[model samples]
Target: MIKLIGILIVVIGFILKIDTLFTVLLAGVATGIVAGLDFNQIFTILGDSFVSNRGVSLFILTLPVIGVLERYGLKQRAVSLIEKLKRLTTGKVLTIYMIARQIAGALSIRMSGHPQFVRPLVNPMAQAAGLSNSDELKESDEEAIKALSAASENYGNFYGQNLFAGSSGVLLIASTLTQFGYNVTGLNIVKASTIMAVIALVVATIQFTLYDKKLNKSHKK
Candidate 1:
């Protein structure tokens, strides 16, 4: 019963619009105290969790760098580069990025496309390509294109990461199955992940192509 205090604290703190990091830490400390844990022990657990999920920490560094780049015309540069390629439509640009992202994931390369690429590069490229074929881009069209651009990164990362034998997802799946008395290995998960990634790529390719045709038709009307 006492251990559930953390959830209550978080809910209340969030509702009050409190400082997020401070609220969470306060909740942790309160919960630890109630659960008979000393401050040192509670901090030890938090520190361990932080260390294990270092990816989240890297974003702290990457975000400011990305912000600095954006301030200096990173997005403008991407749009300008894409505008020079007269034939590449919005869908085609997104498709190419999706494929590249999938391959990077499969090879165990860590690429956080939303922050590192999509927001600053792919989305602008897509908008430029959209403008090339349309007389005037509507608000609805812009929003739709943004959704599709974001989805491309999600599809690639979600389906392709497990293709790596050492991916956390693969290991988790294998371990969970083994706990249930099944004999599954990370290699087995990787094999299945490959098939899923292929299917996803094929499906995404069709979707992007169809979108281009539809978008072109609508613009011509």
Candidate 2:
């Protein structure tokens, strides 16, 4: 039970607004010591874990490039492009991106949205479209717009990935069903996933539309 201090450490670190990476590393070292691991053993385990999941860090490489592009006004370009389409409301922008993301997922094309696209491109575009008026936004409205921008990426990624026949989620489902003596194929899972994806898209579209209405309502009051 004392070994569970790692979780406690994370909670305290976050509450105190510590550097996230340093806090996690400290927590890890503390947990290792409590578990009777020598310093060398703890370092070795950390190294092994890092190596095993290094693929996740690959995105970090894109950060410098993204930063450079943003420094050159990439986000401004995106905002300008979206603003040109007079009919493109904030909700419409999100809906369109969600649709594109879903289609890309169906084709097994990876779109690393949050940092590469959403933060640098989509969020700014949404903010521009969301402004839609000369009036400033209430803090809640601003937060909602940001949340919706992120949610659009999440919705598309989660529901869209399942549509691919070769996606890990589809394969896992087929394999798990086969283990339970139920014959299933990735293609079959994907077929069903397509319907679910459509349903999810519909739901997201409705939410986006309503959010737009809410924004308009807020501004009117």
Candidate 3:
């Protein structure tokens, strides 16, 4: 069908590495034209869609605030706090944070997050632990430490959120299964999520141990 021309345009535009927003807009215009819509109609549709989904841009508001905080030595304070705890290695600190993050998520506390928590606090603390343990870390090692900190937050949130009694994910799962005539319940979903959370915690602990060993080995060389 000629209407499918938009799909082809999308594939071609992506293959050409065109700007994503431009590609999508162009494809939408082409599709609208092929479907017999005029320029005003297409523009109106795009405007309406943008207005409907404007909440997605709410994060933009936090950028300047985060920048101001970073300029005020937010990272330095986090590192200083971690430095006082002499026994906490990078891996141990991240592992402990991961556990706390998971527990918080399960309780629906929603306290830990990437932009609000990780960048401003968790990352600096983790980096400080690494610096405290070693004379100096290579740039690559420092980057890896930051990546691990972010990953720990993500892992904990993903596996633990489902354990919340009335989490959206659990409701969605129950609703979808019920639609297919399956008798899945919210309680069962919570139980399964708890089991998964426990498994993830075990795996995370082992991973942290291995990561610490690797860091120690690198420092020895």
Candidate 4:
């Protein structure tokens, strides 16, 4: 019961905007002790997990860089560049950005859109698409657009990344399949990845077509 309370405390604390890492660590320590982990062992596990994921902390580097870039109007330039292309709609503009970002990720170039770049470009472009100037969006419309944007990015990476021989997932998949008596090789996996990429591209094309129609209606309004 005490261990369960610790877990509840950690979860509730985070949801309530309390210090999350401390809460979670405290809960974990309590749970580990309850489960008979000695203090040393608990610390060791914690250290291992922390060290293993330390690279994720590098994301912090982006925030200041984005802020500096945005202050200089990088995002404005991105938006303005697209705006000048009178044929581009908000959805189309965002779609292109998503595709390009994903492709970069697959190639291990690793890029992201956010407060520094996305808000300056995507948000304004969408506004230009004839959405009400009001700052609010209908929940349904927001959800739909968000889903489309997420899907575009995910599909781009999914279809492109596996092409690399060095991709860990390719090796993992091949190994797992071999265990199941499948005779898959690295080359075969690459071919399969190519096929999947083609499928994803087709789906993206269809979505773009639909979004184009929506943009037309928006412009007409």
Report the C-alpha lDDT of model 2 over 1-221, residue by residue, as the tens digit: 99999999999999999999999999999999999999999999999999999989888889999999999999999988877876777899999999999999999998898999889988888877877753576777768888999999999999999888888888899999999999899999988988988998999999999988888887777
Query: What residue runs in model 2 are displaced by over 4 Å at the alpha carbon?
Result: 1-57
- Candidate 1: worst 10 consecutive residues by lDDT? 131-140
* Steric clash pairs (candidate 2): none
Model 1 gets an lDDT of 0.90
Question: What TM-score does each of the candidates earn?
Answer: 0.78, 0.74, 0.71, 0.61
Better of 2 and 3 by TM-score: 2
Candidate 4 total steric clashes: 0
Model 4 CA lDDT for position 22:
81
For residues 53-169, write the lDDT of model 4, one tens digit per residue.
997877888788777887998757765665566666546655676567546645666555454445555555654442433234456555666556556656666677777655787
Clash pairs (backbone) in predicted model 1: none
**lDDT over C-alpha atoms for residue 117 of model 2:** 83
The TM-score leader among the candidates is 1
lDDT of each: 0.90, 0.89, 0.86, 0.68
Candidate 3 TM-score versus the reference:
0.71
Off by over 4 Å in 3: 1-59
Number of the top lDDT candidate: 1
lDDT-wise, the better of 1 and 4 is 1
The runs of at least 3 residues in candidate 4 whose Cα sits more than 4 Å from the true structure, single-residue gaps closed, are 1-52, 64-75, 112-120, 126-147
